[model samples]
Target: MHRWMDGVIGALLVLLVLVGALRWVDTTWRPVVVLQSVGPFVVIGLGLLFVGTLLLHRWWMLLPVGVCAAVAWAMALPTFFAHTVPGPANFTVMSANLYYGRANADQVMAAVRAHEVDVLVLTEVTPDVVDRLDTAGLTRLLGHRAGEAHADTFTGTMIYSRLPMTVVSGTANPAIEQTPSLQPEVVLTVDGQQVRLKAAHPMAPIPDQTAQWRAGLTALQRWKGDVPAGDRLVLAGDFNASFGHPGFRQLADGLVDAQRTAGQGWVRTWPVVGRRMPPFVALDHLLSRGLGVVKAGDVAFHGSDHMLVWASYTLR
Candidate 1:
């Protein structure tokens, strides 16, 4: 009976190792995307396997255990190292999804004022919240802005900046029906530098919205702004997808995630379920191509489901 039980444990360990191997090469299979969210959990399972093998005095079993542990670490390696950020930042930026107007206006504005955020990106905007934002006098700090108040749905996206921003002609992508995912291009002249900014919130990656979600990320990946080659480009918002997702990996391959650059990728900013409970995922982000992140992190604000994601960058 003891021999049988040992055989069962060995088989289970081999199965877990195979599952970890599949995650790296199974990108094309859509259903396998669900396993992407559990990459970190695979590491936990590998640790258990290592401990179990030692307890059974099967030293030879360590070979498979080591191989599986190495695979899991490689899958999660990007989260472990910090990308170098050089020089002093000229300005700071922040992004947040306000839970469809449920976030506290006072607290939101307070964070803006306290952080002195130069650029603010908001997702899931509503007419009521827009009015409250205007009333809170954030315009006193952020003078140039663009956002159409949509009363029908939580599809609104807005960007407010301290630098003068002008709408870039013919910059909107009309194929995207989801307003939050629509990339609104604006050129801000900062210290005589032309900085192009775009805010995007892709469709959520739930089972039913996979097509729409992929489309949203694809649109952003294919988007080409009218900015000059020398000008800076900034992409910031709640992408609804993380680095683990294939779509974000494609889009982010061309840009640098500020949190990842600053070694703060583990600081999650969504589903503000509780102060003590760690967030299940990090959904909000700030990305850029021509900027270097000087500092980056997130904070929980009152009433919103998402914590505010903030980053400071220097021209690169």
Candidate 2:
């Protein structure tokens, strides 16, 4: 019994180090990308190491335990130290994925209204729901919007803004038809300056869709790189990739993640479980290149698999 228990503890400690090492080599390979999404679980690895230390009573255990703890802290430091450089918040933006049109529109609207969101982006939008929103007065209420609503697929996406907006790459623009993502680019005159808003929905990085997913990311990268220096840009949506993923990190090269900037990156919004389990991944984001986040967090949306994410940002 003693030998068996010792072996179990030893194996657990080794597994912690192995997982941490795997994360450092984060790749788009199926298993690695999946593991990277749950990178926050490194905390659990630390916990297992702590237990091993208590049970193993071996000097060698301390080495792996310290290594595991270090890795966990390194992964979590950004969430703990996140803060906007220095600025005053001007407006709020929100993003929500409709779970393939299963989300409750009433709940979504309530959250948007409560947050006083100036910009709202929704994915997995269906034409029927678009009609419903219009009938419920959202069309006139929002005033400025863009999207092509489709039915029965997770491809539909829409953007609504209370501010007057000109469709620069979507809505009436024919160029957006070639892109894989349903991202709509719009220019809004905010505080007397032209601010660009983009609603992005990247393809999920699954086995078969990996090529399409990379292409979608490439399109976004090119768009970001092409934006003029004077125009402020904000990108918001369900990226289908976590912050730890290489693709998301690449997307954030020049922009700042609102939640990470506001010290709220630890707040997860996706996979909102129903049976007492809380969310574990942060897949939704509001990223800005010329804005600073004053506040950001997740809001609950009924009947949706993803929680609504909102961010208040200031001109930078």
Candidate 3:
């Protein structure tokens, strides 16, 4: 019986290692992409499996499990170390998905006030939710606004800023043509400096929508590439892809993940309300370039499944 249990544990560990390896593959397959989002958990599972192997006296399996866990840890190590440069916090941005316009507007507004947010990006916004947010004093707090609110679908994204801003045409990449979500870009004048911000809501990588999801991330990558040298850019919203996804990694290549820069390890920000389990994967992000990250964190609201992600940065 002990031998059989050891064999079962070994098989599970092997399967987990294979799943963990998917993070390196740049594929648009729906299942693989979804599985990749749990890469961090896979590392944790490997560690648990190593303990199980040891308890079962499976010495042979220990070496492989330990090595795989080590490799996964190494890959994720950078996010655990602080990379922020010293600078004064001149900007604070927050992002959240409204869960098809069901997120608590008052709670969101309270977060903005508490964080002293300079800019707010919201995804899955609807016309009704926009009205509710306005009633909650969003416009009064952040006078400048851009992006459209859709009534028929949850494709809407909006960016509200305390500073002056103008709606700008987003990337003309054809890949975005198939994306179901609306990605809006805006230019804001922060302390006499032009900063570009985009509210990104990529299609989720589910069956039949994997292609669109990949396209959405690809379009964001194109947008990043199109930015001129020395220009600051911030892409904030429900990206629908976690750091484990290759497409997201590509989009984030030249950008700084605010949470990672602040050395926040394994920060999960999704399914905080509806799921039976606690939040497990971070689907929202505030990725930027040409900025100094001061701090970052997430706050849970009443209705949305996703926690609001906020980051303080210095306009370098």
Candidate 4:
């Protein structure tokens, strides 16, 4: 029994170290799709190490490890609320991904109405749902909306804007069966300035694999060149990769994670309501390179698995 326990402990520690090494390498100069792009591999790895220490009765070692872990987690708390930063342009706009099957569309819609975000981005949106919003008089009620509808599934992607868009990318996902992701893009005037925005909610690795999720990412990535460099960019989505995952690294290469830039700390945005498990890491992110975020916060619950998120940003 002692021998077996030793081997198990050793192996777990080694794996944890390896994951940390990968993340350290990722932070250097590697483009998007590095480990930090998805789930936080460091946190995950350290957690496993702590668990192993506890199980092996390494009380002395566990104490220090526990303290470090607590501090690290404590440092990531700023992202849960919203923040603001001044830039060369307008005051702000916003983005979020509404998982289609979350509790229900009505709850999510109510949040949207209450939040009154300048610009809205939704993923996992179905055409039927969009129709409902349209009928609810979004253009008249909220603002103007542009989105894509798929015959296969009601869910796709969309964007709602208070300002008129000058350029837009998609109200569509990358592509499904020769189709794109159900996301949308809109360009609009905010305070007499034109801002280009992309509201994206890419596929998750769960209920699938890293490879499959990457395929969806590939589609979104391919669209980069089409975006104008002068315009401020906003990319929001529920990318499953934690901070240390390779998949998120790929996408992070081109864009900056709004969470890292503006979020106060390790801001996690998933499973906020009645969560059975602790949110292990940050999943939902609003990112931009040319834009400046003034405020970012997680919307309160709407009976969905994900908490709605919004951020105000200036066009730079």
Query: For every model shown, what is its TM-score relative to the native structure?
Result: 0.86, 0.88, 0.93, 0.70
Instruction: Give the poorly placed runs of model 3, Cα more than 4 Å off.
Output: 1-6, 170-177
Better of 1 and 3 by TM-score: 3
Model 3 residue 211 CA deviation (Å) reads: 0.7
Better of 2 and 3 by TM-score: 3
CA lDDT scores, all candidates in order: 0.73, 0.75, 0.86, 0.59
For 199-269, candidate 2 gives per-residue lDDT tens digits of 88877878976656656666677778888876789989988777667767787798888888778747688
lDDT of 3 by residue, 5-83 (tens): 7689778877998998888899887778878888888978887888888887888778888888788888788788888
Clashing pairs in 3: none
C-alpha displacement of 194 in model 2, angstroms? 1.7
Tell me each candidate's RMSD, in Å, in order: 3.2, 3.0, 2.1, 5.9
User: Candidate 1's residue-wise lDDT over 220-258, tens digit each?
Assistant: 776533345566888888887766677777877768788
Residue pairs whose backbone atoms clash in candidate 1: none
- Candidate 1: Cα lDDT at 92: 83
Q: After superposition, which runs of candidate 4 have C-alpha atoms over 4 Å from their true positions? A: 1-12, 19-92, 101-106, 131-137, 150-155, 167-180, 206-209, 272-276
Looking at model 2, which ten-residue stretch has the lowest summed lDDT? 172-181
Q: If ranked by lDDT, best first, what sequence of candidates would result?
A: 3, 2, 1, 4
Clashes of 4: 54
